[model samples]
Target: MACVGESNGLTFWVAEQKDYEDVMSISVNIYGGNDYLPHRYSDWMTEPDRVVILGRKDSKLVALESGFVVDEGRTLLVEGLRVCASERGRGVAGEIQRFADQYMQQLYPTLRTKRQTMSDYHSSESTKSLAKFTELGRRAILSFTGDGKSFNGFISHLKNKLNSTTGLDKAVSVQQMVPLEDAHHLKNILLDPELPKRVQLPGGVIIQDWQPFQPIKGNLEILARRNLTWLVNKLEKPNFLSFYTPPYPIAFDGGSLRFNIDMFGTDLDSAKRAFVSHFEKVMEKGLLTGKIMIHVFLDQSLWKEMKEFCAGETGLKLWREYWEQVIMERDVRGGAEGKRESNM
Candidate 1:
C-alpha cells in the first residue's frame, strides 16, 4: 500500500486486503456501530478497477476513502470517504484528498473531473446538504423524485388494480436485481450474456456490467457507474424506470429498494401500471413490504388523471416531490476541491 503522508500524526495509505477490517470498522459514532455498508462498498472493495485507502494513527485505523477511475483516467470518483470520530478535526480527510490528487496525477495525467454523489452517503446524516453543496462547480443531474405509501393495508387494496385493466394497453416487465450468484429468477434482465453490460466512461474507464436501459447522459454517469441496475423497463412512451438495490441491503425493517423513473410525457397511467407491477413482484419475492417509494416528476398533461388515480387507488400514493435537481456546473479540470468534512 502506498503511503499518502500524514496529518496530526495520523498516517494514511492505500488500502489492501488486510486493511478491509480496519476500514469496515470505521463508522460514524452517532450510531455506535455501522448498521450496514452500502452495496457499492463491497463492489469497490473487490473490484480491480477501484481503489480503497485507509488512514492510521499508529496501529489504529482512523480514516478511509474509496475511489474509482472513470472515463478512462479522465475522472477519479471518490466513492466513499470517512474519518473516524477521533480523527475528525485533525485534517486527515484533507491529507487523503491531497494524496488522491497526486496518486491520480501520475497514472491518469489527463484526469479532468473528480466526482462523487449524495447517494454514496450511506451512514452519514448530512447527505442532503452535502449533495447540495457539491453542486457548486460540477454538473448535477436530476436523479429522481421520491414518493411512498404505507403497507398498512397494501395487499388488500392492491387486488382491484391487479384485476382490472385501465384499458391503458400498457405492459411493464419487472425483475428483482440480485447478486449473480444469489440470483434465482430465470427471467432476469442482467443475465443476458451477449449484450454490452458495461459502459465506458470518457477516459476509457469501463464500468463492468454497468449497463443501463439506455445510454445515460455523460454527466450522469457519476450516478450510474456506482450503483448496479437490476430491473429496468421502458414506459409506454417517453418514460423510463430503473430499479437499483445498492450492493448491500439498507434502511430499517428489511431494507428498501430504490427505483428511478423519468416521466417526460403523458403516460402516467402506464407509469402507474408499471409501478404496481414492479411493486407486486417485489412483494412476491418478499424483497420488501414495509414502505416502497419512487422518484418522478409528473407531466402537466397527466396531472389530473394521476391525482385522481392516486386518490382513488388504494395501494398506491402519489407524492409531488423532486428527489434532487441536476444542476450543471463548469467543469473544474484542475484537481477539484476536496469535499468538505460532513457527517453525511
Candidate 2:
C-alpha cells in the first residue's frame, strides 16, 4: 500500500531506495537533462537527506523534492525541487516546498532554530526559481562577478577618481601572473607555508594575490572544490577580484558553488543587464578597490555575443562607452605614467 498525504495540491509518498531509479528518471525528465543524475544520486546516498515524490495514482511522477543536511549542524539545504514538464504550472513545485519545510520541522525540530540555506540559487539562470523559492521564506544570497574587461574599466575609473583626490597614481601592481586555469595551483601555494612572502599593499597590509589570467583547463569538479576553499577563506567580505573566464566557471575548488543561472542559456542583453545590476549593487555597497583583478574569460562565442549585444543596445553601448571614456581619461591623467614608473 502506498502511503499518501495531501498538502499542496499533490499527493506525496515516501520514496524508497527501490524507487531511486524511477525517481531519477523523473528528475532527468523534469530537468530535461540526464547529466545531473549521477551527482544527484551521489548526494542522495551520502547526504542525510529526504526525497519526497509527488504523483497521482494514475501518474508515474509529477514532482520531486530533495533536501540535505548541511554545515554539520542544524541547517538543512534544499538541494533541488523539480516538477514534471506536464505538471509544472499546477503549483506542484510550491507544494513540494511547503511539504519539505513542514516535514523537516516535524522530523528535526531543532532545525526550526537554525536557518535553512537554499544552496544553488546564485546563478542568473536559477534567479527566477530561486526568487520563487525564497517567497516561501528562504533567504537568497547572490554571488557577483566582473570579467576582466569590466573589472579593468571599473578599476581604471576608480584609480582615476582616487588619484585626483590623493595625487597617488599607483596603488598596486601584479607581483606574479597566474593562469586562470591554475587557480588550483594558487590554492596549493596559499595552503603551503614555504611560499615567497605575501604581497604588501599600500596601507602596510600584506595579502596574497591570485590572478587567474587564462581559462581553466582541467576537470571542473576538482577546480570547484579547490576554489570553494579559497573563496570561503579569501573572500571574507564582498570585494571585486579578477578571475579570468566570464560567467565564472560553475565549479570552484570546493564542491560546486551552486547558483541558479544557466550561463549558456542567457542572451547577451540579459547577461549584460545581470552583470551591470550586480556590479551597481556591489558598488553602491562601496566594496570597490583598485587591488581587485577582474578576471574575464573571453571564449570566441561569449566575446562575439557580448560585442553584438553591446552594439545592438543603446543602454549597453552607453555603459560600455562611459566606462571606456573613464578608462581613457584615467590613463591620460597619470595612470600610464605611473605604470611606466612602476616598470622602472
Candidate 3:
C-alpha cells in the first residue's frame, strides 16, 4: 500500500488485492497464461507468509515480484516476477527489487540466503535479471510424462548417461516421482518388513534398526485447521522423510517427490551402498499409473561412484532419451565460482 519509488512518473507500490487483475494480465502477456504462471495474484497475496509487490505508473501496472520465506526464515525463494513490455529497460525491475530487498530486511533481519530458480525456457533477459539478485545454487533437469514406466527405468536412464564416455560427466543423478496414490508408497517402503531396515554398506557395514518417523504433532493439529498454510508448509519441507539418528529426507511437491542422498561421514563408500540399497528398495515398489521425471544436478559428486558401480556386463545398462529435461546451474554466490559445464 506504500509507494516505494517512482520511475518516470510511474509509481511503484506494495500490491493490494485491488491489483490482482493487473497482476494476472501482466502474467498472461508474459507467460501466455501457461502453467508456468498458473496462479492469480490473489493466490499469492492472500497467503499469510508471502510477500507480493507491484510497480505501476498512472494507474497502469508495470512490474511485479512475488516471494516467500523458507528454511526457517533464512532463505527467500522468489517464485515469480514480471514486467510489462512497455516498461522494459526502464529500470522498473531494479526499482521493484530494491523495494523487495528493503522489505525483507525490515521483516526478517536474520535472513541470509536469497534463492530463485529459472526453467530452461525462460527468456534470456529474465535469466540475467534472476542471476543479478541471487547466485545459481543448483540446476535440476527434469522429465515429465503420463506414460507409465517402472522405477528401474529411472535408474537405467542415469546409468546410460554415466556410461556415455563423452556426455553427462558433471550431472548429479536423482529422480522426481508423481505417484498415483498419495505418495504413501514411500511411507509403505519404509515400513515394509521384507526390505532391509538398515544402510547396508559395501563391506557389509550396516546402520540398522530403521524406524518410521512421525513428525512432531505440535503443529499438525494447527496445520490441519489451516489447510492452505499446511500444504505450503509441507511443500516447503519436501525432503522431510523421517526422523533418524542421521536424518535423511525426501521432498514432496504435491503428488511428486524428490530424493537426494549425500554422504556425511568418512565412510563414503558405505554411505553410497546404503543409499543405493534405499534407492533399489523404493524403485522395487514400482508405480501404478503416472510417469516419474528424472532430474540430474549437474555437479553432484556421487555420479562417479554410480558410474563405477554400474560398470561391466553385470551392471545395469541403460540408454538415454527416456528423460526430457536437463538443468545447468552456475554458482554466482561469493562471486562466480568458476564456470559450470553441462551436456544437457
Each prediction's TM-score against the native? 0.55, 0.38, 0.45
lDDT per residue for candidate 3 within 1-344, as digits (tens), equals 57766655667676788776677677644422122333335556666557887777788887888756544555554556778877777777767765675576577776665555444455365655554443332322222221234445544644454435335443644332222123344334333332231321211111111101112222223222222100000222222121111111112223333232322122224323333344454455542234222222222334455445444443233322222111222222222322221111
Candidate lDDT (C-alpha), each: 0.44, 0.36, 0.41
lDDT of 2 at 167: 54
Which numbered prediction scores highest in lDDT against the true structure? 1
In model 1, the Cα lDDT at residue 254 comes to: 45
- For residues 240-311, write the lDDT of model 1, one tens digit per residue: 333433322334234544443333223444545544554455455555534444433333345455444445
Clashes of each: 15, 35, 6
Our tally of clashes for model 2 stands at: 35
TM-score winner among the candidates? 1
Better of 1 and 3 by TM-score: 1
lDDT of 1 at 273: 52
Q: Which residue ranges in model 1 land beyond 4 Å of their true spot? A: 2-4, 29-40, 119-238, 251-267, 289-332, 335-344
